[model samples]
Target: MNTPPGLHLKIAEWMPENGEVVSAYDIAENFGITIRQSRAFLTILEKDNAIETRRGKVMPITCHNSHRRSTRTIKVISIDRDIIAQRRHHYNTYRHCPLKSINGLSRAEKWEFIIRNARRRKK
Candidate 1:
């Protein structure tokens, strides 16, 4: 597939070795490309099915097919906490429910609460 010069190199640097989804905006800013150019490049990737786009900050990209095994790669930056806080401030007006109750609910209850609430937000 035709790609811009240094695209793969930048991809390698930005993506984890195990390969995880990344944000197009973040990639664009890191590569010094305009948002328009980044969108076009991302379209090219999507046409090839090189990446799976979703309406979120993170989009999953195709990693090497040779490595069929799935690997979980945590993000380098842990800004989700701040982001969630900001989101809460902006959108969440009601009392926040604790993932785990003060009584310390079972693991299933905690997981269920988080999963249910996370799905309440948009992508």
Candidate 2:
């Protein structure tokens, strides 16, 4: 429904000026979303071409404060307006896509839906 676009815009607005790196954890912390959800949102933004990503070195929260953990994290680049416009138009015309299914669901419900769907697919 309105959540994804609204959230996309919110994330876009919250994005740092171009060239700064943002990890999924940064987004989770800023938006109160689960890390998994943040990652999923990042994936969606990437597909929309609203954000770009690259491997980066960073500290993981679970690690010791002094140690910067090396992992597979990729930093998300800033927002792209033109891509958002194009994606928005395409989504409007094709309402049966994945993003459309969780439209009216609350965050918790959305997670449930995601998990449930994943389980079904694994069957």
Candidate 3:
């Protein structure tokens, strides 16, 4: 099934690695999608072997002053190998940020320095 771009990335980021249970409602609330959409997305993930699900007890939820309860089963999603590799590469690439050592500089001074250097690089 065709899914939205970055959906898998978002799911990978949100899901816990310890096999914690997550409900469709939780996914819907987190991603700002409808519960039906969340369920369908979970089904797609299941078909792709990205997640496992089990029937769970009813639970209550509150969002934006609204309250509701649901009996939807919880899905335990895992990060795919590609996503894990991407995360590792990103962390490695950005871990030692150059700006991190800008000691004794005020926030505005730091911003000025960054902007000045960035502009110089464009020449």
Candidate 4:
């Protein structure tokens, strides 16, 4: 399947590795893609280490194989302090940060940036 550009990143950022049980139908309905595409996306998520196994299952979905069934709602993962800090450290910027510009900045560099900004703000 020809995957869309940056689709994997979007999926990873949206879905937690060990959180939530989303149905394939839900994924398809929300992403406006087909069931086959949704299944493929799940595989891609796994490869990228995006989704983690929960109870020995990556994502246990209901009525995944049945398209005729009502689409299940997406489960929202409860964000804790660790996850928030992780997102901040890894992302190094806003969630929808364009080009992930700040991610590559080192800790020292980030400190310097903060100091520089603080100095500027003091003026």
Provide the overall lDDT of each model, using Cα atoms, as 2-decimal numbers.
0.49, 0.64, 0.64, 0.56
Compose the digit string of candidate 3's lDDT tens values, residues 71-118: 355554444677556665676675676645678899999999888778
Compose the digit string of candidate 4's lDDT tens values, residues 1-123. 466876745655565652566665557777788887886766655544334422223443455555454433343333344654575477744556454366789999988877875844455
lDDT of 1: 0.49
Distance from true position, residue 21, model 2, in Å?
A: 2.1
Candidate with maximal TM-score:
2
Deviation from native of the Cα of residue 69 in model 1, angstroms: 35
Candidate 1 ranges beyond 4 A from true positions: 1-9, 17-20, 49-123
Comparing 1 with 4 on TM-score, the higher-scoring candidate is: 4
Model 4: how large is the Cα RMSD against the reference? 15.0
Model 2: residues with Cα > 4 Å off, grouped in runs? 1-4, 58-72, 94-123
Q: Best to worst by lDDT, what's the order?
A: 2, 3, 4, 1
Worst 10 residues of 4 by lDDT: 49-58
TM-score (C-alpha) between model 1 and the true structure: 0.31
Q: Name the best candidate (by lDDT).
A: 2
After TM-score superposition, the amount by which residue 74's alpha carbon in candidate 1 deviates from its true location, in angstroms, is 15
Q: State the lDDT of candidate 1 residue by residue for 1-84, as single tens digits.
A: 344764733453455542555555556667777655665655544443333333334334465542333322222221134543
